[model samples]
Target: MAAKLVTRCSLLMQVLVFFLAVVPDAFALPLNRLKSLTVIEEVNRRGPYLGLITVIESEENAFFATGAFKPHKTHPFVDLSGRRFRVGKIHGEKVIYVRCGVGMVNAAAATQQILDLFDIKGIIHFGIAGNANDSLSIGDVIIPKQFAHTGIWDWVNLYSTTNLSDVVHLDIASYNVPKGEGTNLLGHIGHRNEEFYSELGKPNTAQPLFWAETSKHWLHLAANLENLNSTMNLSDVVHLDIASYNVPKGEGTNLLGHIGHRNAEFYSELGKPNTAQPLFWAETSKHWLHLAANLETSLSNGFPVIVFRGLSDLAGGQSGENAISKFGPLAALNTAKAVVQFIKTLQ
Candidate 1:
């Protein structure tokens, strides 16, 4: 049920045919080749303008499909390496729009190009994110204050009791971090006890369980990059119980919303799982957050970088989870509007 970002995303809409049911004959360029083949000539260009980034064509659902106002002007541009990108002015805002394929590599590549080539003052990556909070419903939007990478930790183990243990180190870590900030947390399974409620809230007894007691070996969290540190109380951390993983699939969603002062696991798992009941609600900023965080740090221009994600699909609310990330027109549309409204306030 996703729409195109108007004409610019028509091809991407086709690329998402696999995600939708009404599959149609569509054309798609290799996501990797979305950029130009070589550096663009530095003709007349401008930035400090707002940068609007999205993933895939469907995510472009907002700015493109809305018939509110067309791009005042569509300027052809490409990365220094030749990757293509679209730029234009709309609603009196100079904006650059790129369907930066999907994944960290593509996103990082595009972000580097934007930082290296443009005079951008801010970057806002807007699109859909899966639900991680019980109070939030479908179509709700979240401008997170903090976000962490999921695969960055070393090991997180759950014990038979309702206790969890985890550890993190700087040695094997792959991402960048401040020096002396390493060796943040340490513990084995059952070190701490905590409860994690389903962000989906209470589930109907008739429905399948969606919330699972998950574990995390958090080496770092970039919810607010302005404050990154490698110091956290090892004893204060919650220990995940073995029940976290033994919970059966289709067990149903958590309906009571009764997760006591259980440690909160607020996070977006990102865009990767291609399965039904895709792990987290599919609306997280995942890779986009990492890229934007790094870019903002490197610039230090007070270049505010924001991420707003709308609920495109319920974590386990779809029909067998096939459409978790597909039917996001509403989320995409709302998020696009959020971007415009936010920039309008700035002006």
Candidate 2:
């Protein structure tokens, strides 16, 4: 049995605060706004176990979460954080692995603990999400430049509002930088030799700009950085969340994400046992992907945030009783391979 002993969040926060007090521009955003992921008793002596680890956040649905892990050693659990990482070399790189327990909050919380505790070069978030774009098939991979979380919207500061135009604009840009910001050790989203991921290096075009409304930072989504402030409308919409269409990246991969927020009853409430896909499962990455990367970046003051996700189903786009069971593994394994390939080039 794992011991109940674990370090408290307050102590971690205090340690972070002590650092923040010494350095003014140390953090990218306010520390209080971020979620507190629990990490327990530190492991003594840093060696192979302390290096960057590939994280597998697979456990959301019935499909993408299950797969076999190769021979590896199980390290002591970061008990309070509820994680016991598997450590071993992967393709010549010393690495660790953790299957983020299902859902958004669990994903975020666990990611924070890893980001906070590990001596990571970067993070590769590999898992299955519902595919909403029609052009892509069951196994195609997607590396999003900017991620759109379905659960959040910027309302008109009104109570009990449901109308779209009245109060609806995407908030909190979940970003993935393939190439590390400057000389940082993190790998590019795609192969460094590939020109596709390099565009993000061009600030005006690739690197995004943001608008802050009080504490909440909202990413401006338009291709034209100048229009980041443009009003939100179906006409001015940079992304179409639900339904099917040709994503700007063209047919092969729709990297611009339309991720959904769902809970236990998300399927039944939407009449999901039916033929059509539930649009809500678009991007399953919870809020933690960026937080983990960002906090690490802040601590290192340079490492880039690279968020990678893949699709197992169309969030119910198909009509097979066993589709998720079939394709989930395909997407998860493919996504994992893609991440490992990317990681191979990091050093």
Candidate 3:
């Protein structure tokens, strides 16, 4: 009887040890615990995680604040801006609208912060871009069929020069130039290219004189000429120059310019408050490439990024002074509308 009792006592001790090894300590730190173990603790410590949506813009004029809407009763509007403003939801969807400040630095910072703070699934960068191509006009929208970083060219070029050209070729599919008397006039100008010039007895003397005289009347003539010259093919180059020459004085609407890093210094000299430049002002495709790269990085890291642009100005060699008066407000309104529409679509 004593032996049997002793054996039972030994078994009881072994059972206790086994149970202790299998069970987790209740008093362990919340963060130090493994995910599976801490899930219960997390549930106790905080409520269920919420879905996230982010909206980014360079400026306030590009976006407007509508009052908050709550789709989920439990998750109230959380004001990220220290009570001045609340991060609210769009009507009928699980969305949090945020105003990401201007430039790639601001945009990237804001995006990182939002991701760190919330469980964001996607981000949409809706704002304005100057018309890089003549096919796009003021109020026209661009939804990057492909994205590239204009800034990364040097880095990529260091390894492979060919890669740089390939990137530009991929990122920019087409641009929408403003449609107006300017377009029509420019069309006429294009007809006078080398092909046409050769066909019409190479009217070099007449063409140069006409271009020089028209340059005095039009502020954008110089830039237009530069753009015409830069196009890969002569046909496109000639066509663009001719088009600029023929655009009637009062035909096209203007868009605002948003300054990217490339043209900021030059535009700063214009004495205008540092505002966004229009599409026409953006002479180099480099800025768009920069924007595309930055956004692609964010998107790769589980963030949703969308780029929305309003044709604000004919950026290349055109005066915002002339275009802004006619199209500034309209462009702003159009941009705002696009943002709102994008939000609604999220629903």
Alpha carbon lDDT of each predicted model:
0.45, 0.38, 0.38
For model 2, what is the alpha-carbon lDDT of residue 31? Answer: 41
lDDT of 2 by residue, 109-153 (tens): 655556566665444454555666455455544444332233342
Predicted candidate 1 versus true structure: per-residue lDDT over 1-347, tens digit per residue: 34445765877677676557433223234333333332223322455556667776676756676543345243455544444556666667776666666766677567656655666766777676655344544554545533333333334322222222432223223232565575334323221111222223354323222222111211112232212111211011122121222124456544433222232222333231332222231224353344333333323333456666666554433334433344466566666655555555454
Q: Sort the predicted structures by lDDT, highest score first.
A: 1, 2, 3
Tens digits of per-residue lDDT for model 3 on 1-347? 99999999999999999888866464343333343233333322343222232223333444443333443344333434221112335555455445554455645556555555555555555444545454445544444423323232222222222332222332111222552322221111011111112223334532211110011112222222223222211110101121332234456543433322211000110122232233311124323433543454454354445544544445443633534345444444454444454455444
Better of 1 and 3 by lDDT: 1
**Top-lDDT structure, candidate number:** 1
Mark the 10 consecutive residues where model 3 has the least summed lDDT: 187-196
lDDT of model 2, residue 159:
28
- The residue-level lDDT of candidate 2 at 6 comes to 36
Q: For every candidate structure, what is the RMSD over all alpha carbons to the true structure, in angstroms? A: 20.5, 20.7, 20.7
Which portions of model 2 show Cα errors greater than 4 Å? 1-80, 154-303, 320-322
